[model samples]
Target: MSESLTIVGIAGSLRAQSYNRQLLAAAGELLPNDVRFILADISNVPLYNEDLESALPEAVVTLKQTVESADGVIFATPEYNGSIPGVLKNVIDWLTRPRGQSSLNGKPAGIIGGTTGMFGAVNAQMHLRHILPLLNMYVIPQPLVLISQIQNKLDAAGHLTDETSQKFLQQHLDRLVSVARRMKNEQ
Candidate 1:
């Protein structure tokens, strides 16, 4: 049998009770046995700075290494002022630095979002879809997940409790795994 596919998952929210983080946790539980989803900790990643890029802070180095080692990436984000949160953008800046040789180059990426608002995180996901291509990432085209009313989908413990939401999340994971597998072979 072929080796299991590894995906590095990043939650774009730092709040202790963030719905985006809860969505990521649900995704981790729903991934298939052939796919491994590991959540990358973004809590320690410092704000991006050109001077720090020379030495590359430990957290930044770790984030890059985690992304580079994974077959694909899954971003669970929240919209902030109609775009990605500042912390998430900071991490992306660090990952895309040095111009041409970004760690995310040519890698397949799946983006999903959870928000309390009725629009979910549609704007943020749309913006990321445009930005990722510039970073050389092959963003998946299908099974886009924008979880609205997220507070009702998961429990206080961060587990997915809604049947409909679980099914939707599973579908997203399936698509991500399939696309990542195909991209892996293409590379």
Candidate 2:
């Protein structure tokens, strides 16, 4: 039997009740048996500092290692003031360190999110579309997920209970796995 593909997920929100994190949980439940989703811990990642770039903190090292080990990455972010959240951007900056030796190089990635607003995390995903390519990531093009009205989609335990949302998430996960598998085989 083939080994399960590992996808590292990063939740951009730091809030305990963040809809994006809940969306990630939902995404996790929908993944296929051949795909394993591992959520990256963002709580301990410090603000990006060029001086510390040479000697990354232990948390940052672990984060990089997690991404490096994964077959792909999924970024679930919350749009903040018409842009990506500060913490999310900071994490990306840290991941893109040493000028030209980014950990995301040649990795496949998918972006999705949930938000209270009507547009969900559209702006944030757009920003990532532009930014990720610069870091040498092969991002998926079609079927971007921006889950709006998040409060109505998740249960009290932060699990996605809405059937329609689950279908949507499944579609995205399917695409992520497909693209990630192709990338993995190419290497």
Candidate 3:
């Protein structure tokens, strides 16, 4: 609470105009003025290769430091074949890292997503809820935001335009920041 809270967002999809990416891009607008939202870049990260961890790629190091520094993380994922995207999973693998120490350990995380499908990305979010805890992250359990039929919600420029969805996303970010603040204060 004493310092400005920094919450980072990582979109699992690499497509420039993907719904998840647009959602993450618009997250800052819905957050409190004091809270900072950073959209993490995962494009340069190579596929998960254990052989490369000994020296860690430059992009990997950058991402690890970014995640380690933030008070909280929001994973905007797109469900691919009923599960989380491989790119996002690859990034997590990088974060879990060299040993018992992980950047994600004990950090607060929130899951959110949008999709054209009727069910949204619920399966992806659920998968993340189960996986993140194993790495020691605190995943937010309430006020789920599974935005379905995202094409109708975002404008041509990819910004979220629906007032109702805006309010909901705002609430979700607020809660994520609340949990992050609590954890930081406790520490």
Candidate 4:
């Protein structure tokens, strides 16, 4: 049997009740036995600084190591002003540092997010999709997991209550694992 795939999940929002974080929790619960979903804490990742590249912050170093060792990455972002939030962008910047030596190079990534708005963070997801390739990350192209009107769909415990949404999320995660394995084989 093939070894299990490790997928690191990062939620862009730092809010205690962020819909994005709730969506990540649901995804974690939905992961299959062959796939593991690890939630990464980006709340303490400091702002990017060129000076720190020589001696990266402990948080940055840990973030890079975690992602570099993972088989795939999942970004759960909340849109702010039609784009990704500053905190999430900061994390990305730190990971993309040292240019061609980024940890995301050739790694598979999936985007999932939740928002109160009707569009469900589509704009932010698109922006992220555009950025991941620049860092040499392979992004899953199908089954976009965008949760809209999340307030009505999630339970008090922050779990996805809609059956259809749960099914789709599971499908997307399965696809992510498959793609990640394929990429690993190619490398």
Candidate that scores best on TM-score? 3
TM-score of each: 0.94, 0.95, 0.96, 0.95
By TM-score, rank the candidates, best first.
3, 4, 2, 1
State the lDDT of candidate 2 residue by residue for 1-187, as single tens digits.
6557999999999998888887887788788877888988989999998999778899999999999899999999999998899999999988888688677998888899878889878899999999998888888876778788888888899998877767777888888888888778777
Instruction: Give the per-residue lDDT digits (tens) of candidate 4, residues 1-187.
Output: 7677889999999998888888998898888788777899887788899999889999999999999889999999888999999999899899888777688888889998878888889999999999999888889887888888888999999989988778778888888889987877777
What are the lDDT scores of the predictions, listed in order?
A: 0.85, 0.87, 0.89, 0.88
lDDT of 3: 0.89
For residues 37-75, could you state the per-residue lDDT of candidate 1 as single tens digits? 888988999998888766889988888999999999989
Least well predicted 10-residue stretch by lDDT in candidate 3: 1-10
Candidate number achieving the greatest lDDT relative to the actual structure: 3
lDDT of 3 by residue, 47-83 (tens): 9898997899999999999999999999999889999
Error of 3 at 81 (Å): 0.4
- Please tell me which model should have the higher lDDT, number 2 or number 4: 4
Q: What are the per-model C-alpha RMSD values against the true structure?
A: 1.3, 1.2, 1.2, 1.2
Query: Which stretches in model 3 have alpha-carbon errors above 4 Å?
Result: none
Q: Which stretches of candidate 1 lie over 4 Å from their true place?
A: none
Candidate 4 displacement at residue 185 in angstroms? 3.3
